[model samples]
Structure formats: structure tokens, C-alpha cells
Target: MARILLRSGKSPFDPVSPQQVIQQNLIATNTGNLLFGDAVHKMLLTPGTEITPNRYQVDPADADRINDEYDVFVVPLANAFRPSFKRHLNDLSALIERLRIPVVVFGVGGQAGTDYGTDHLAPIEQEVRRFCSAVLERSPSIGVRGEFTEKYLNGLGYSEVDVIGCPSMFMHGRELRVDKRAASLEDTAGLAVNVSYDSGNIPGSVIGNGLINRLADAALERYSDLVYVAQELKDMELLYWGDVSEAAGTSSPAPLTRSHPLLREDRTRLFHDSSTWIDALRERDFAFGTRIHGNVAALLAGTPAVVLCHDSRTLELCRYFDIPHRLVADLADETDLAGLPAQLYEEADFSAMVDGHGERFDRLVSFMDRHGLDHVHKPGGDDGAAFESELETVDLHPGMSSWKGGHDGGLGYRLAWLREADTRSRVRQSASDKRVRELTSRVGSLERQIEESAVLAKELAKANKRLEQLVKEVRSSPYRRLRRFAGRLVRRVRSRS
Candidate 1:
């Protein structure tokens, strides 16, 4: 058996949130981290293979252990090539260079706005080069998300690059089908929407944040069952912790927050795992979101999805996979909220997208095979039947909700973990101190005994030395030699008799 190590952002064993999730909110609250990680893990699922828990963050300190523990390392990244992530890319590059085993990258892409410009990554060109070169050294070619990344890497003088889209999209492998139960938007339609309000760099883009919030507002008001999906930790924080006042801040678009009327009314939910996220979307009539993974989750669930592309990172993937999407700016001219979701659903056809998936899936498998990875879905085999069967047997984790109003599953979650850790530390410290005092008393007693023993040993040595001198003096006497000679002569006469 071979172990395929998954290098991801968060460990799959991340503590189940202590917060009790409303049963209705369970599917909506799954974090994208879990969603992405789960997809990659399941994608590589094969007989006689093992996958390690995510080794979060690339630290040079863990390189040796990683190489020794796993045979192959697979990285499924999203928009990893950006100035903001340059430092991380450098660190990962250094770590990759240290890895003696093969490293396969899937869906790694450069980030920019909708312009698809490469200028943003200029500062991190060397970092990207080093990272790509390191992966190419271990694998046949670097699998990229789309043409933009292909061009980006080619410009950097990397020839071994293939546009493999994203592994997350192929969570179910080749076969994908989404049915529109409703021809038009109905009040009873199960609508799922996601927004990416956490793109801090483009903080001021009205279309990026404001338009999605507007669409969400309209959908929530008109639809009976609408789920607003948030893909960032901050959005999750606001959903669970931020009070109405903080959510009402000018900086916050309340429509996407817990303060939203629908969210407050218990029509909103958050998801922490992909299984629930995908299952939740499976029940939805339509899912449209600014978050690429948000829509990708819908696609994986076989639900029709529309991506509100605000940047190049999303644009390229949508284009590559033919995922139905519209620019966020287009929503500005739209007036009717009730029909907008239906309109987008009708206009966006996923047949070509779904039809082309088989080839793309094969491309992914070929890439994996070239890197010596045996995937569950063989090229000409029964698509993803084996993968799905294996997935069904997985005892998946349940999604978590916020404990209260502050845990964003990042700092707040970590803070809660830290508090628990501190408490444990105090308890351990108390026990350790008690043990230390007991050991100290025993050591003192041992030291005292050693001192006493040393004195006795010294006295015994002096006595022995005197006894040795006395024996030497007695032996030196001529009388002692005459007695010994007489004893020997008597013994010889006795033996002769």
C-alpha cells in the first residue's frame, strides 16, 4: 500500500466545533477548507492506498518527517499565486525543494482581477518559479487551474504545465448532472447562494461585495427556502458571533450577515464539512455565488450553479470548466429579484460543461498517473463508481455551528482552543510541580545517603590499607618464612607416610 499525503490548509481532524448546529444549518456551515480537502482525498481514493491527515502549512521543519512518512504528496490549491500569498509560496517552495518524494499539484492558479493580468504576480515571480520548478522536478507536469495559469507559468519558462482545472470540481469524478426542478423561481424553491465578502484586497469593489449582497437580499426576500452560504472565516464569524450592531457597520453588508432579516429569521445556515455542503446543495433548486468553491460545491452536488465572477481566480476556473457564470457587475442592472435567480438558471446551461467533464477527468487522471498516483477512477474504467462506493463507506464528520457570537473558526476558534489549552496547561503544571517536589525530596535523600556511604567507604579504605601494611610486615619477617617452610616439610612427610 502507498500513502498519498494531502497538503492542505487545515487538518481534517480539526476539533468539531463545540457549538451545537441547528440541524437545518448543518449543511450550510461547512468551511471550504473541509470541502476542498475532502474532494482531493476522495478523488485519490483507491484500493490498497492510504492518505495522511492534512499537514497544514508548509514549514521546513516538517519536511524530513513528511518525506519519510508519505510516498507521494498531493497539493490541491486555489489562487495560491498572489502577492499576498508570496511569502507562503516561498515557504512552500522551500519545503517542496526539501521533499525527496514526488509532489503533485492540482488546480494551483495565479490570482488577479477579472482582467486576467499577470502583473500582480510579478513581485513573486521567483517564488512561483521556484515552487513550479520544485514540483516539476518530482512530477511530469504541473496541473494548473486554467489557461491563465498555463500562460502565467509558460511566461515563467515552465513548459511542463497542464490546465487540469480543479480537483474539487471532480469530487464525483466524470459524471455530473444538475436538474432544474423549477422552470422559474418559485417561493418554495430551494435556493442556495454564496458570497465572497472576505476579498480584502478588493474591499471597495461594489460588484464584488455589494452586488452579491443585493442579490442575496432579493433571493432571501422572495424565496421561502433560501440559504446564504458564506465561504470566509469572517463571514462565519459574523454569522455566529457578530451582534446586530457590528453587522450593521457601514463596512459590513448586512444582507450577508447574521443581521440579515432572513438569517435572523433562521433561514440561513453555515457548513463546516463538504459532505453536508454538497448534500445541502443537492437539495437546492439553484445555487449562485461569488465564491468559486461555493458554486463548485453546487456543481459537485449535481445542482445547477452560477458563479458571480469578480476576479481572475474565479473567471479562469469558470471558463476552463465551462461552469455557468456571470460578471458581478451584471446584477447591478437587474431589478426584479424574484426572476433573477430563475433567469440566471435558465441562461446557464451545464450540458457542455458536464459533457466535457469526462475528458477533463481523464486529463487529471493522466496527470496523476504520470506522477505515479493510482486514482480510484481509471481512465477507461467505470468512471467514479469505485470512488463513490468508497465515499459512501466513509464515516463522514458532521458540520459545526458557532458556540456563540465570536468564533470565526480561525482566531476566535483558536482563542477558544488556547483557553482550553491554558486550562490544560495549568492542570498539567500543577501535577508536574507535585511530581517535581516528590522527585526533589527523593534526590535529596539519595544525595545524603551517598555522602554517608562516602565517609564509610573512606574509613573502610583506611582500615584495609592498615591491614594490608600489617600483612606485608608479618610476611617480611624471617620467622614467618621458617614456619611456612616447616609446615611444607611436615605436609610432604605426611603425604609420604
Candidate 2:
């Protein structure tokens, strides 16, 4: 077993809560790094080894637990590997530099597509060079995910960079079985639209508006049923808000699917494994996905799929596997799918693409062996098996995958209705604002009139009481005549004075 260091340059805590974030970071110190990087770790790291005794902390002191125990280090990252995190990447760079250990990257993605210069990524690009340059300086080979990533590294003047594609898509050597007369459910066609919150820097309105919907309709034309799948928990919230907000007042049939144990408990719901949703996708004829893993699920199940391309990660994987896809800009209009279902491709025809990916995998393997650590995939590769066991520790129990609504899956017409409702809501809000101002003025005037009337009533009551007392005095006196005399004497006394 090769003692190793696995890396993901993210803080393990929620960004919203400082306390929770602190707790998450603390947990990472105990664990070292996660068992595997998001996509590639599973590819070469094998299934049965502990990557590192301690993980997840950038502070070298916390990571020092394995200063001597580990033989090699594998850093798995996404597109751009900068210190966008709290100095985590820099710290990892320092560790590699000091130990003089071999470091290999597994299909790391995340550079803002190759279209823009590294200058756009700013300080992040600088920091990436700082870390990567040190590793390359030590003679460890580096691998990247796509053309964009490879270009970014080359721009850095690093010579040994290789384009490995994403570990998520293995050039599965097996041929794909395509059902040509693949009939959807009776009377209608079935279309699967996978929703994601992390649009890879995509705008919310883009997903909410006609862009993603147009593709959904294309898939729906040939099917009677359409459904949306969510891989992460937050994705569930996005599907409704993104789709419902757009579909309001509209008769859109965009209902959410539920898994078992629908408790509002903590992180349990969101952490449900990808397997739950993958099994669910097998029931559908075709799936259209924006999330990388969503498409991965489709291929894993041998289902025909189309990548609605957005950013570099999606584009890189789709092209590498020779799968069919469309970009966001292109898919905005119905014209995007000019040939209709012709753009969809079977996952079986990707052997060349898979073979192309082998060089990157080889680099990952080479990095491990260079450090004297044997991955479990190799002849004596115990590390790979142990790595898998670690994943087993994570409960992939996704709550209820099946919830309500089997009959009315088509909500396309309903989405149109929702658009009308949203317009009405805006109109209502304007009307309500005007009504509030009018009613507020009326209330103010009424309050002042009531206050003035109260004062007049108080004065009237005082005068009435005085009159009653005088009448009582006069009436009780046998002395009405005496009162008159007293009044005259008072007048006389005034005149004499």
C-alpha cells in the first residue's frame, strides 16, 4: 500500500456559516484530504487504500502527520488550480517542494476556457504557476483534462503537460448497444432533462429562460414523458426555482422527483450518492445533461445522451468521448437542433476517444509509481482497493428517488402559462403599490378628522354638565325668587362701585 496525499483545494465547510465552516475545516485536519478527488481519484487511486493519514487542511503542521509515512502525493483538482481557496493550493505546493516528492494531477479542469488569456484568471494564474512550476521543477509529470487546460499549462511554459480528459468518462472499451426503434412510452415520447445548480459560471436566467427549455422540448417531441433529475440536494431547489419561476401561471409539468427519507435534516439529503439518480435514469430512453456527472450517469447506464455544452469541462468530456452535444449559445433557439434527434450519439463509439485518454491515465499511474507507491490497479495495487473502501464509508443513501406524479409529466405547455402568471404578478404588484398609497392617504385623513371630533365632543360634555349643576341649584332652592333678587343686588352693587 502506498502512503499518499490526496488533495481537493476547497474548504470542507459551508461558506455561509463561519462556525460550520470552521467545524468542517477542523474535520479535514483529522481526515487529511478526501479519499479521492472528485472525478479522477477513482480512476487510478484504486479502491482499498487510505490516500493520507490526515487530509483537507492547508496548514502544513496539520498535514505533517504523514511527512514520513507517505511515499507519493496525488493532487486532484478542477479547471484552474489557483489559490482561489485560502492559501490551500500554495500550501500544497510548498509541501511538494519541501519533500521533493513526485506529484501528479488527475484530469484537473477549471481554467476559464482556453479562449481567454491566463491574464483573465489574474492572481489565480500566478498562484497556479507558483505551485505547478515547483512540481515540474522537481521532474514530476502533470496531466490536465482538456485542450483548454493543456493550453493553459503550455502558456505557463511547462513542457510535460498532457490532455487526459475527465476520469468520469473512461474510454469504455465495450461497444454501446443502441436501440434504433427505441420507442418511448405509449402515445408520447419520454425526455430526460438533468438540472444543475453549479452551471460552471453560467447565468441563472440562461437556465431559467428558453435556452435549456428548447432542448427539453426537442427530447420531449419523441417521448410521452419528460422528467428532471437532480444529483446534489441544492440542485433540487434550483430546478423548481429556475423552472417554476419561469413556468409560473404557465401549465408547465415541471414537478420535482423525491427520494426516500425526505427529512429537512442537515447535509444528509444533499449528500445522497450519484448511484440513486443513475438507476433512475436507466428508466428513461434518452437524457440531456448540463452537469458533467449527469451525463456520466447516462453513459454508465449505457443510455443514449447529448451534452448541452456550456463551459470547458462539459465540452472537453463530450468531445473526448465523441458524444453528440450542443453549446448554450447554439441551443438557445429551436434551430439549434436543426436535424432534430440526429445529434444524439451512442456511448459505444468512443473507443478511439477512450484510447486517447490513456496517456493521461498513464501519467497518473506513473506519478504514483515514481514515489514508490503501488496503486491498487497495478499487479500489487492495494492502494486502489483501499481507496474504494473509503468511499463505501460515505453513505450514498439518496433519500426517496421516487416521489409523486407519474401521470402528468409533460409541463411544456404549462411553462407558457407560468410566463403569463409572472406577468400578471408584476402587474398586480404595481396595482397593489398604487392601492397602498391611496389607502394610506385615506387612513391618514380619517385619523385626523376623528381626532378633531373627539376634542369637540369633550368640550360639549363639559358645557352640558355645568348647565345641569346650575339648573339643580335653582330648582332645589324654594329660592327661584331669592336668586333673582340676588342677581339684581349684584347689579346695584356693581353700579354703586
Candidate 3:
């Protein structure tokens, strides 16, 4: 059996607690990452192929082990060409430089504003080049998220790039069916809403004028059964611990504060695993949000969703997949904000996305074939039956809800919270002690430096005094005066001659 190493925090079947997921950041900072990772993992489970999650490790020292143990290294990424991910890109590049196995990247994208400009990406241009160059050397081509990333890489003088949307959309193989169950959104029973808090904070952003948050607020007020699906680590922290302390000082009208209805009413939830996330969304009538994966999770659950494209990353992916979306910039100018959800639900067209999925899946499989990687969707592979059967046997955790929510205030829940809180407090104290020790060591080094400087100053002072005494002695010598007077006499004789 061929061994495939995947870049993921953990296997999808591995059930981790909310506290450990938060503490270790097993989702790699955003639970959204697991969506694509899990999709790729399921896709690559062909016969005679065994896959293992790498736990997000990119250590160059482990290159030899990987080379000997694994036949291929597959990476599924999201907006990795941004400035914030440059260091990680460089680290991955360094590790890839030493690997002898094939390396393939799936649905990697470049993040920019809604204008799709690459001027802001100049800072990490070299890092991007190095990462792409390393991957291409080991593989036939690199799969990009959409048109913008394809253009960005082509502009950088690379031709070995393909637009494959995202692996998450192809999780169910070639067929994706999304039908509007309710005749209208208002007639729907439940609504799932997701938001990107930072979307409202970015300067010059199309969605920066509180447009995304306002839409979320409208949905919250209009639908009594609305559930806020959060994807960020901080949101998970808030849902698990009910600690709105991070939102304490923020005065922004956006959901940055606990005063928001979601937190106050315990209407927010964060999923530790993607299966549970999709399973929970299965009960919702429709999902709409700025978070791409959040809506993708809804679609995976066979529920219709519309992506609110706030930037180039979301816009490009939605366009590639033919996923229904609306530009937040355009929505900001509309006067009727309350009726926007109904309009979006009515306008969304899922036909093209569903119709073109087979071709896209074929393209993705072709890309994998060119790189010598096998997938479960290929001929003679069982179409992920084994992966599906394995998933069915694992008992995954449910979505994390607020501590104050219904049935969550029970004694068992409170005990778990207390234990987790105590563990967190101990971690904080340990961190504090570590910081104090560091400061004490720094202070000791500074004192030693000061003492050395003082000793050096005294030595210099003694040397200066000795030099002054020697100079005074030389001036006071009579033989020295006679030599000077003779020299003056010789000069007067020469002038006369």
C-alpha cells in the first residue's frame, strides 16, 4: 500500500474535546481549515493507498523520515499567499526542498481586496514564488482556488497552475445537489447565519462599513430560530467558556461585544469537528454567511446556502464553483436591509454549480493523476465507500454551545467547565511564572553589564591619571629644555647663512 501524508491538524474521525481543540489549536487556528482537509482526506482514500494526517508539521529535520515512509505529501490550503502566511509558506518550502517525494497543493489561493489587485501582495512575492517553485518541482501542477489566484501565479511567470475551486465542494464526489426547500426564506423554519468579524474592520474593504454585521443582525432579528455558526478560535472560546472578556473593551457595534444578541441569548455555536458541524446545519432551512467554509458546511449538509463575498478570496472561489453569492459592497448601498435575505434566497441559482460539478471533479482528478497520486473517485476505487463506512463508525462530538444555553447549565456541564477553567488558570499562571523568570534573567544580565562598565571606567580613569603625571615629568626635565634651545639656535644660524 502506498502511504500518503496529508497536511491536517488531525484525522476527521478523531474526536477531540473543545478544550483540547482550543488549547492545542488542532484546527490550525480556524475550524474552516478542516473542511478542505477532510475532503482531501476522503478523496484520496483509494485502494492500495493509506493516508495519514501530518498534524500540520513542516519540520525539515523530519524530511528523511517522510521521504522513506510516505510516497506523497498532499497539501490543502486557503488564502496562503497573504502576508500573514508568508513565514509558514517559507517553512513549508524549506521542508519541501529536502523531500524526495511528490508534493501536491490543492486549492491554494492568494488573498486580496474585492478589486483583485496584486499590489498588496508584493511583500510576500518572493515567499510565494519559492513555495510554488518547490511544489512544482515535485509535482506536475499546483491547484489554485480560482481565477484570481491563477492570474496571480501566472503573472509571477508560472504556467503550472490550475483553478480547481476547493476540495471541500467535491467532498461528496462528482454530484452536488442544492435545492431551495422553502418557497421563500421567511417561510423557512430555521436559518443558519455566519459572519467574519474582521470583515467590518478592514480599512478600504468593500464590506468594511459594517455591511456584513448588519446583514447578520437583520437575519437574527427576522428569524427567531436563527443559529450563529462561528468559525474562528476566539468564537470557539466564547461559545465553550462563555467568556466575553475579550469583547469587554471593544465599543464597535459589530458582534465584537457580548451585548450582541447571539452571545446574550446563547444562540451561537462552534463545531469542533466538521461532520458535527454539517450534521447540525442539516436541520437548518438555509445558511448564509461571509465565512466560505461555514456556508460550504451547509451545502455539504444538503442545505442551500448563499456566500456573502466580502473579498477576492471568497469572490473567486464562489465564482469558480458557481456557488450563489452577493457582493457585500453592493448590498451596503441597498435601503431595504430587512428583506435582503428573502431576495438572496430567491435569486440564488444552484443549477450551474450542480451541472458543472462532474467536469470540475474530473479536472481535479486529472490534476492528481498528472502528479501520480491516486484518489477514491477514480475507476475501480469504491467512490469513498470505505471512507464513508469508517466515518459512520466513529462517534464525533457535537457543536459547542454557550454554557448558559439550555441543558448546558447542568451539574456535569458545570463540573467540566470548572475543570477546564482550573486548567486554563494553571496554564496562565505557568505562563506568568515563565515571563517573570525571563525578566529576572534579563535583569541579572543587565546588572552584570553595568558592573563591567563601571570597572572598565575606573581602569580608564587610573590610566589617564598616570599619563598626565608622565607628561608633567617630561615637561619639568631640564635636559629636554636644553635640547629645545639648541634646536632654535641651529635654525637662526641657518637663516643667517
Q: List, in order, the clash count of every candidate structure.
A: 11, 54, 0
Ranking by TM-score: 3, 1, 2
Native-to-model Cα distance after best TM-score fit, residue 414 in candidate 2, in Å: 28
Candidate 2 has its poorest 10 consecutive residues by lDDT at 260-269
State how far residue 325 of model 1 sits from its true place (Å). 1.1
Model 1 worst lDDT window (10 residues): 18-27
What does each candidate score in C-alpha RMSD?
A: 17.5, 18.9, 5.5
Candidate 3: tens digits of C-alpha lDDT, residues 1-497: 98999999899889888888888888888889999999999988877787899888789999999999999899999989888887899999999999999999999998887888778789899999999999989998999999999999999999999889899998888878887887887743688888887753223466656777787787778888888888888777666655433334433456544557787777888897888898899899888988999999999898989998878889998999889998887786777776787888889889988888889999988988887877887778888889889899898888787766456546544554575688689999999999999999999999999999999999999999999999989987998899889999999999999
Measured against the true structure, the TM-scores of the candidates, in listed sequence, are 0.73, 0.57, 0.81
Q: Clashes in model 3: which pairs?
A: none
lDDT of each: 0.73, 0.52, 0.85
Q: Write the per-residue lDDT of candidate 1 for residues 154-256, one digit (tens) a residue.
A: 8889999989887888777767787777667677888888777655363323454466667777777788888776665545555555443322343345544
Sorting all predicted structures by lDDT, with the top scorer first, yields 3, 1, 2
Better of 2 and 3 by TM-score: 3
* True-structure Cα RMSD, model 3: 5.5
